[model samples]
Each structure stands twice: as C-alpha cells, then as structure tokens.
Target: MSEHYEDDKSRAAKASFYHAYFSLKNILIGSYIVLSILVISIFAVVTSKVTEQIITEKENRAVINSLRNIDDRITLKLDNYGTVMNSLAYSESTQTLLKQASELSNQRQLELVNEVYYRMNEVNVTNTEINAIQLMDLSGKKYTLNNGNYYMEGLMDNYFESPLYDQVRSLNGGLFIDYSGAYSRDTNNLTLYRTINELRGTRPIGVIAMSIKKQALGSILFQDSDLPLTSLIDISGITVIDAQKELQGTESAISFNSFTDIASSFQTPLYGDNYFITYLKNKHYDYTLVNRAPIGSIYQDVAFIKKVNFYLILFNLLVVVIIAVFLSRTLVKPINELIGLMNRVRQGNLNIKMTNPPLNEIGILANNFNEMVTTLRNSVPLRKEQLIGKLLLGRTADSGLLQQAKELGLPAFDSAHGVAVVEINDRSNIDASGVSIDDVEILLQSELAAIHSSALLHILDARRVIMIVHGEDEDIVPYLHKMLNEQKNIPVTIGVGRFYASAEHIHESYLEALDALNYKHLFDRNGMIYINDIQAYVYSYEQLDVLEDGIVHAVKYMKEEELLSMIDKLFITFKEQFVSKEAMNRTIVNTYLKIFKLMSDRGIDLFGSEQSNIQVPSINNIHLHAGAHELKREFAAFLQSATRLIEERREKRMNETIAGAIEIIQSRYADNDLSAGNIAKELHISENYFSKLFKHETGVNFSQYVTTVRMEAAEKLLRQTGNKIGEIALQVGYNDANYFSLCFKGAFGVSPGKYREKQGN
Candidate 1:
C-alpha cells in the first residue's frame, strides 16, 4: 500500500509542473523572479567594489574643499588686520600728532595724547580681535592703548637699537608681521608693525604695532570637527595654530617634506595610527594648513554604509518582485487589445475607433491612433496647397505638381507665367492700419482676380505675399500696377518679374521679383516696381568714403547734430541719384563697418561698457534689417550711442588726468622747482593743456593750487615746529627767507615772524 501511494504522488507532482510550464502568467512570474535575483546578486557584488573607490575619491574631494575654505577664511582675517594697521599708520590725525608730539608743550602734548588715545580706542572697539595697539616714536618713547587685555611692560630704554626696530626698518616703511609675537611674548598673540613715515618724505616718524589674539583666529581655522587633527603650520613645519591649545607653537605632528605644491595629500603613520594627510598652502601668507584623519576610522564609516546598502538592496528586491507580478497581470490585457486594433489599421480600416480606455500609456496610445486617423483624412486637402507652394518655390518637380494638381481638381501650371512678390513697407504699419497680413492677402487676391482673373496667391510669411500669374511679362506688369492702384490704402509694395515659359523656371522670376522689391524703399510710398525698369546709377564709393570719414569725425568729437545731418544727406543722395538697391546697401554697410572699425582701432567697445577687447561687428548681421528705413534708424541710433560713449571716455580721461596731477602736486609741493610745467612734464602731458584742464576740473589754476598747498604746509610748520625762518622757508619749498616772507605775507597778510607771533609762539 505504501509503494502504491508513492507512485501516485510522483505522477501528480509531474502533472502539476507540466501545467505551470504551459501557463503564460505563471511562466512570466517565475522567470522574472529568478532573473531579478540573478541581476541583483551581480549588481550587489559590482556595487560593493565600486562604492569603496567612489568613497575614497569623494573623501579626497571633501578634504580638498575643506582646506580651500579654511585658506579663504584665514586670508580674509589677515586682510582685515592689514586694513586696520594701514588706517592707523597713514591717518592724517595720527601723522600730525606723531610728527608734532615731541615739539608740543607739556600741557599741549597731554591734550594731543588724549586725542590720539581716543582714536585708537575707537579702532580697537570696532575690531574686537585686537588685543592692544603700541606706538614707538623715533626718540624711543612708547605709548600703549589697551582694548580689554591690558598688560604692559615699560618701553625699552634703547628701542632704536633693539632687534624689533631693526626688523621694522628692514622692511622700509612696509608692514611687518611677527607671527611669534613681539609685543606680548604670548604664543596666542601675533603682532603687526608698520614704520610710520612723513606723508611726502621717507623719514621714519614712528612705529605702530598691533597685537591680535590667536584664539580669535582659531574660531575659523579649526572648523574640521570630525578630523582627528587640524593645525596651521608655517613653512618651517612649526604649528602656529592647532585645535589643542598646548599644540600651538609646537612642530606639526605630520611631516611635510614631500609637499612641493600649494596643495598636497598623502598617507602617513602618526602616533601609531595610519593617517591620511592633506595640506594646503595659503597664497598670501607663510602658512600651510594640515588635516589628518585615521584610515581605520574612514573604513569604519564605509563599512556602516555597506550594511545600510545591503538592507536597502534586499528591500528593493522584494518590492521589484511584487511590482513584476502586478505589471504582468495589468500589462498583458491592454497590449493584446492594442495589437488587435493595430492589425485592423494595417488592413486599411480607417473607420475603426477605440472606446473608453484607462488613463495610462495604453490610453495615450489609443488616443494617438484615433488622432492619426483623423489627420490622414484631413491631409488630402492640405497637400494641394503644399504642392502649389513648393511649385512656386521650385522645390517640387513641375511634372509632379501637375499630376498632383489634376488629382486635387486644381488648374495645372503648363503655360508661360511670371511671379510677383509683395510686402508691407513696415510691419508696424499693419498694426497702425488695424489689419492683419491675412486680411491683406484676401484683399490682394480679390484685387488680382479683377486684373488677371486666374492668379494664385500664397503668403510666404507675415511680411511677404507671392503671386503666380499665367501670362506674359507685359500683361502681368500692367495687371500688377492696376492691383497696386486699387489697393492704395493697403500700404503694400509689389515687384513684377519677367515671364518664363514653364513652371520649372518660376523661382527664377520669383528671385528677380525679390531683388526688384528691395528698390521700393527708394519710392515715397507703396507702389509697383518692375525688374526691367530699375535704373542702375554710378553710386560713388568715393562718396561713401567721404560719408564714413564724416561719421567717424562727428562721433570722435561728439557732434550729434552733424552725425544726424550726414545720415539724412546720404539717404537723400541715394534717392536723387536713383541708386540701385544693391549699390545703396553696399554704401550704407561699408560706412557702418568703417565706423565700428574706427571705434575698435581706438580701443573702444561701443556695445559693452566694461569690455576691454574690441569686438568686430559681423557684416552678415547687417542684412537682418527689414528695410532701408530700419537700417537707417539703427545707423542713426548707433552713431548717437557712439557719440555718447566718446563723451564719457573723454570725461573719464580728464578726471583721471586731473586726479594724477593732484597727487603729484601734493607729494612734491616742498620741492623748489615744483612748478606747473615740471609737474606736467612728470605726468607726461602738455603744460598748457594740463593747466587748462586742471582749472576746468578743479575750479582753480594749477599754479594757484600748488601755492595753496605750500602755504598750508608752511602755516602748519610755523605753528607746530620751533624752527628758524630760513629753515621753515626751505622746508615749504621757498629758496630764500625774504621771498618766503613776501609770499607768506601775500598768503596770510603777515610776515613769517609776525605769523608765528600771532599764533602765540
């Protein structure tokens, strides 16, 4: 009984497997599930290999981007420091106080010192990172201004002979940065020093030093919170800043002997951990930023990502299997229906239609099929017009057009015919007349029916109408003229071409008509022009040459009135001389090109305000104009703009020259030979022109301004310094004390001694 039961179960299982193999839905589901598993397995293996490489590459890019950002932050902070130091060193108040500090009385000196302290305090309050500001005079006296961190040691007795002074003097009045701290000896503080010089001379007046808190800079430099180590290192591998306070001013933990460029990365072992190191050199400073991360930690992150990816892949595989099963059921029914409908269409059943369909790709397909059938039904009517247009354009064979025309129940173009091209003078006129080109085409066809009775009209575009008439040129021209006279209110111009014997040659006449229509701009109003009737004149290229010169000269000198008048004269000349359209266009285009070239040669960009390189205008672009009037209008506007640009350039040049002359006068006013002529020669300009320009721009003559500057300096020295009359005179650019007294008397209405006495000297 057991053997019999086993044989029956095996037979039943074999029959079930055969049924599943023959079933389409079951077979599709099974095949998809198996294929999905195979594809997913292969993809997971490949992705595992590729993800590691991609992670490494992404890590490299992230490190590089981090270094770049840190570099920018550090440089910006340093520039802010430089700006503060510059303001303190060159301020007029600071300069005057420092230069006159030693000469003032005990009480007056105390008052000036209070004023200087107030200004420096304001600067420190504005820049919270500043620790303190120190000033050392040429006499070895030092003054300190504290923000909030106030710790001061007395000034060195022999400051002039100290190493700090030597370093400051070595830079020749330029700024000096002491990264190791000179003022406070604190590793957290960096000092910036500047040698204060007289405004015009190279004599050192004093030294100004400012100490900045490194803790303030650390806020921006140590932004890599995830990294194990981040530090700012100098070229000598000394750590200037580090995330750890104790590490500051110590040697960098990573060696940089292999780095040769501004940015570099490598793998190194540090403190028994394999670290990936990336360092970027600051372009404006003597520092390199080093970032170190452990290789084991990076792989740990990659391993976690792999675990998450595996789970996601497993979940996605389940969803894909479910989707495959559902799509197989939903897809087969609509696809089968689509195939049946397409079969009917292929068998020439244009009447079949699909009833309501579900909103999906299948529905879109059904709707498209219905639309395509309707379009085929309507296409027959349009083919006749399409063929006719092609025939007029010579794009279709004449024989092919004849056969199609007979089938569409239209007249065959088998006889002599000529083509006329019609266009509105301006599209703007169409709007002004409250008429569309379609209405105009209808009116034109009605007028043509009365003259030729069998003419066909086609609108090529919004601006043009093409007409085909089966007749001789003599007959066609008269009919076109009559049509033009009847449609006088339409604002349309027509050009008639000579007749050809057959339709194949119709485009030849069409082309000639287009050429003839170009001359219609010469007429005062809309009318008919004939190809044979156009008279060619000896339009002078020499005249165009003269016009170009006139345009350039007018623009160069900013003569707007002359530019407009010349353009008007050229158009009038074209009309009076009966110049052919080609010759007229040539003259205008040549003149335009020459004008732009002239601006370009002078290093002027007419279109772009900030463009330095001259861009040549394209010749082909000129032909895009609708008609002569548009070209003429644009030409006039271009000339006006050119004149405006020239005016702006001249004004800018004059301002720059005046500013340069002022700078030179202020710097050299103490020289005895610093006259207007000498300053003008130094600036590489003519003296007479420079004097005139200076007066025009400054509202004062060059010599008068120079004298004013010198007198002001003399007044300051007389009041501030205890000097002899001869010494003060020479200091203020006066050679002799007697002459200085006379000029000073003229300037202040008092002698030098009297002026000093008036000031309570």
Candidate 2:
C-alpha cells in the first residue's frame, strides 16, 4: 500500500512541474509583447512629432522666401521709377513751364500747366500704381488735374508745413506716406515718391512728386495669396501700410492698437501657438514683411495621425506576441552555439570549427564570425614584427648609423665634400605629387647601395645629395662616370678628392671633391681631377692687387672705354689663370671668405655666425687641398668678388668727383654759362660721368642743384631789399618774370607777391 502511494505522488509531482514551466513561458511571451507595443508606440509618437516640426519649419521658410522675392521685385520697380522721374525733372519743357507760371493770363497759365500735367498724366497712366503726379514750385503753390483739365491754386499758406513738403525741401528727393491728403479718406491714400533736381543751371527747382495709391501697394501684397494675414511696417514700429482695411467703431481703435503692438514685438517669428508668423525685413527700405498663418492649418494632419497611431499600437502588440513565441524557440540553439564558440576562441582555441545549419541568416552570421577569427589570428604576428622594427628604428636618427662606419676604419670627415654636394633641381613643376620624403630617401639609398664600398651618401642640410668617396681609389674616374651615367634622371656631378691615407685626412679629400663640384658649370663632361691641378693655376695676391689698380686708374681718368677694356682684361686673366676644377673651387671659397670678412668688419653682418661657422670649415677643407677640378670654381668666385668690389669703389669715387664739380660750380655761380657738360670737360671726365657723379654725391641732379642754389639767392634778395619782382627774377638768372614767379610759388607754397607781403608782416 505504501509503495503504491509513493508512485502516485511521483506522477503528481511530474505533472505539477510541467504545468509551472508552461505557465512561466506564457507569462514571458506576454510580457515581451506588451513591452514591444510600448516601445513601438513611443517610436511612432516621436517620429510624428519630428515630422510635424520639419513640415512647419519648411512652410515658414517658404513663406519668408516668398516675401523676400516680393520685396526684391518692388525694389527693382522703385529703382526704375526713380530713373524715369530723374529724366522728366531735368527736361527743358519742365523748366519752361515753371518760368511761365507766374506771369501768364489765367487761360494761358492753365494751358501751360495742362501741358505739364498732361506729361505727368501720361507717366501715371503707364504706371497704374501712380494715382496722381504733380509739380510744385519752391513757393508752395498747388496744381491739380481734373478729368483732362488743369486747375491752379495760389500758394497754400500751410503747404510748406506739411511733412511731405518738409521732406521734399530738405532731401530734394524722397518718398513719404501721407495720412492727410486729398485722397486720404478714399482707398487711394498718398504715397508721395518725390525727386528734386536743378533746372536751367542756376534755379533750385521744386520737387516732382508721384503720389502712388495705398490700395495699389496693398494689391502687390494680396496678389499672390488670399491669406488675410499680411503686414508691412517700417522699423520704427509705425505701420507704413498693410493689406488689412481699417474698420469703423470703438472696437476699430482697440484692434488697430493691438495690431501695432503685436507688429512691433513680432520682429522675429514664433511657433507652436495657434498662429505662426514669418517676417522678412528689407535692407534698403526701413520696412519689414510680417506674414502670420494659423498653426492648425499647417499641421492639420497631426490629429488623424494620432488616432491612426493608437490603433497601430494595438495591432502591432498582437503581431509581437506571435513573433515572440517563434523567435524564442528559434534563437535558443544558435545563441547557445555562438556562446560555445566564443568560449573556445577566448580559451586560445581559435581553430575550432562549427557546423553551419541550413538556416540562411544564421549560416551567414556563422561564416562571418569564422572569417573575423581567421583574420585576427593571421594578423597578430605581422603586427608584432612591425612594432619591433619601429621601436629599433626610432632609437636612432636616419644618418646616425653612418657615424659607426668611421670607427670601423672607414673614412669620415667633419667638413663637407664640395663636389659631392649635388643640388636636386626640381624641374617638374607639379605643385603637389603624393611622393613622400621617405620614398625619396629610400630611392636614394637603393641607388647608392652598390657604391657604398667606396662612398657614403648622405642628405645634407639643404635638399642636396652629398657623397663621401674613398680618396685612395686608384681610378675614381670609373665610379664618377658610372654615377653620372646611372643617375641620368637625377643630374649629378662629382668633385674628386686627392688620395688621403687616414680618416682625419678625409676633410682634405672632402674639400677636393667640393672644389671639383664647384666647377660643374664649366665642365660639360663627367670627369675627375687632382687637388694639385687647382693650386698651380690660381691667381696670387699680387695679381688681384694689380687688377684692382687697373680698375682705379680707369675710373680716375673718367675713361669709359678704358674702364670697359680693364673689365674684359680681368675676365680674360681669370679664365686663363684658374680654368681647372680645383683652382676654381679654391678661388670661390677664398673670395667668399674675403667678402664675408669685409662685410663683418664694416658691421654689415652678411650671415649668421652659426651658418657661417659650418660653411667656413667646409670651405677651408677645399682650400687646404687644392685640385685640378677647383680651377674653374676659383675663377668664378674671383670674378664675382671682383665685380662687387669694383662696383662699390666706383660708387665712392663718383661721389667724390661730383662733390668737386659742385664746389667749382659754387665758386662760379655768377657765370650763367656754368653747366654740367663744361664741368665734365674741365675735370677730364665724360658728361655722363659728371651727371652721374653729381647726382650720387649731392642727392640731386646737376640742373636741379644749380636751380636750387639760384632760388636760394633769390629768396635772400627778396627779403633783404625792396627790389621789383622782375629785377629779383633777373638777379636769380631767370630772364622771364612769369617763369621765376611760377617757380617761386611752387617751392614756397605761396605766390611771390603773397610771400613778399607775409615777409613784410
């Protein structure tokens, strides 16, 4: 009996457990459906709000843009109106009409007035907005046209007091909106656009005023839309005018006041209320276009959308419940598999493979996961290796490894090799090509790798290629030839150094290479030269001194032909003496050093000490080891220095010559015949030389100096004695009285007569 009871209890417990599991499943599904409905409903509401806002903003912008377009059209019309009015106001007939107004008989005057009125009426008929047009004289007289007839009235005593007349008189041309005019009570209140212009040269004519109707202006605003909410007001909060009509009664005043207050504050538009206002201000006219529309009209669809959204939420909740049940069952197996695979990957078992089921979406996700794992596994080693390489390279500068070669018995120099300094001229005019500095350096290193046995290539301070080659090579000529031919795309030239036995002697070799390279302009072919070749042909100090003496003698005699001949001789001597590569380089370095020293001594400061310090050391090495390649370099440097020195000396000597000439002129001031050409002839110099010299020394040309000196003498005579103006002119070497007075007035900022009076005072 006890065993039977136990079996029955076990069956009951199993049934109860299954019931609880099914009940929990239903609850979870139901909860998911409810949450999803809530989320979707919230999303629908937010989307509706965003869409409504976007539509409202876009509508307001469209309205504002339309108003601006209307303003532009009106501005253009006004400008055209101004042009026509200007033409009419300046017409000869209008001047004639004004002149005959006061003297003619009533019939004759009316005829004259009608002619003027008819002309204006013709303009008015063409411009429909211009209801009336009139011309008023400065005396405040009024003239009106009635049914093709002209009627004239005597000057209105209070006409000048009107704001329209005040604006017309003050500005000569203006536009005003008049509240009290002949047509004010009617729909056609006056918008007087006036212009004042001169007639017959001397007469200050009255204004030609065109009175445009207020209703016509209102028609411009109402033409596009029948919307009852449009306004135009000046910036001062005054309603210049609007499309709304003024209603009669006690309520009218209150309504108008409310509108005026609202318009003033509605400078900027606001939203979300029952009304939406869009406003645009005119930059030229002090007026604003205010457009108001009902918010309900813009977003009328929101109410229908809200009701539809509520029903959609209910329908979506029902669908969500069904989808949740299926998704929970379907996602369980795949999620378990993904979790297992992730665990394996985390435990360093990256090679694990999972069978992809025939479910299309799940199969794709599995494939992608596998691909990602494979990529990360493969990339790890490569990234580690790259990091190591970067670490090593970063520890040293680009050229730091070359320093170690010297310690290993390889040749190195503190000074630069002149011939090895090849400037890489940029011939390709492309502003930007994507080539990087690393790419250029890599290319250079690859091309120079084979030559590293005898030479070390380095990038110098500038964008120059510097090559330090072994000076001991029996035939560097082959290497030089190979470099020139191989590096054709990159123009290169070599300055070979004399053979040196020790690393310390590398400086001498460097100098030789530099010297040879300096003569690159002279050599058309790839070649090499010994340092001894340069020293043999360079100019001695005595030779340079003799050249200097020749230049001085030529200038002293004021002989242009002789001076030119000396320059030619100097060039020829330089060519003959230092034509070799080594001589040329030595001469260049020496001349540069001398010029640098000269500038330094004279406090000119040609170059910074740091820059000069580096350059001078390199230059000294080239000079110490003179070579055949340096000859051309030496001659070029010598010529450059010689030219500069000669020019400076000539300038100084010319100044001295001019000062002497000036003294001669001052002593002979009484002689009116004293002139530039005569002075030059007496000094045994050419007239051109004399003129140049005079200008250089006195800061004035020869003729200008003579005139200035004579003028000074004239000033003294005018102040010291009461001489006649004509006599003063003659004393100052001027034969013409007018010419002298004119010159005096120009120099003193006053007429001669005025100047004499001021002096007396």
Candidate closest to the true structure, highest lDDT: 1
Scored by CA lDDT, what does every candidate get?
0.70, 0.54
Expressed as tens digits, the lDDT of each residue in 1-761 for candidate 2 is 99999999999999998788668777798787777877878866874786566555546545654565556555545544554465456554566555556766788767766776665655443455565556666765655543233222322334566554665555444444342233233333444445445542334566555555556556667665634577665444545455555521012111222343222222222334556666676644445666777767767766665666667676765564554566455555775786699787765566775675437445544655575567546754443332222222122232433354332333343333222444433324211443333344455556556545445555432344545554443344455455544653443344555655434444445556666665543444434434555544645655554444444444432444655665566545555665554544544455456545544543344355633422223564564433333443454434344444544554655555676786776676546687999999989999997787677665579988887777666666776788998988887778788988888876655667776674562
| lDDT of residue 650 for candidate 2 | 46
Could you tell me the TM-score of candidate 1?
0.35
Q: How well does each candidate superpose onto the true structure, as a TM-score?
A: 0.35, 0.34
CA shift at 627, candidate 1, in angstroms?
Answer: 64
Query: What's the lDDT of the predicted structure labeled candidate 1?
Result: 0.70
TM-score for candidate 2: 0.34
Q: Model 1 over residues 18-115: C-alpha lDDT tens digits? A: 88786888778888867776677666666566666656665665576667666766775776676566557666666866788777687876666566
